[model samples]
Target: MSVNENLAFDALSDRVRRQILSILGEGGELTVTEIAESVDMVGRSTVSSHLRILRTSGVVNERRDGRRRYYSLDTEGSVRDAFLFLQTILRGGVHFDVEATKSADVAGEIQQDVS
Candidate 1:
């Protein structure tokens, strides 16, 4: 998978993927089994596929424990920076306080709040 531009947001566009990120971000690392249990899907394969896309986007990192694989967020700095850059380009003069919040922690959850 390519970690190209907008990959994180693009990957987040899907509900399941976003839920996966939210679960990982709010809690911490988890395996495909745990993630599958949270979402509508009941199969590990489905969760694994979503995790793969997130990992490719640099939005999640993975760690292995024995036969289990755990994944967590990886967009703490880069994500917030991207949103600030967008605000700068869109808002012009950039009056907003970019330092007010951390991007990694919010990620797709912010959009959920606004919508």
Candidate 2:
């Protein structure tokens, strides 16, 4: 598969990663332990490993607060850029750009439309 397809599938493969994104949406930031606890699916180490993938992929941002690490989703702008990488393999050759990312200034635009 292409890089874009890889990213979306990678993001979707583990249930933990999807939940992590949800938690980040709520807390805006969470430590490794906190995330593990919130999901109750696996250990902190497991969550950390997933976080590593997300961090490396530029889907999530991390910051260290002393011994604790906090993570959150990249803003719409950032995620849009990442999602655009998958556009090439969207079952069509159509291209997507930053301007296409914007719909309304209203919050929950993505979540609302998707559901």
lDDT of 2 at 26: 93
lDDT of 2 by residue, 9-90 (tens): 6775778888888888898887887788897788888888998987776678899888778888876434456566665457
Task: Report how far off residue 42 is in candidate 1 (Å).
Answer: 6.0
- Candidate 1 per-residue lDDT, tens place, 20-56, comes to 8788877788888878888774467888988898887
- Compute each candidate's TM-score over C-alphas: 0.64, 0.60
Against the unseen true structure, what C-alpha lDDT does each candidate score?
A: 0.73, 0.72
| Model 2 regions more than 4 Å off | 1-5, 76-78, 82-115
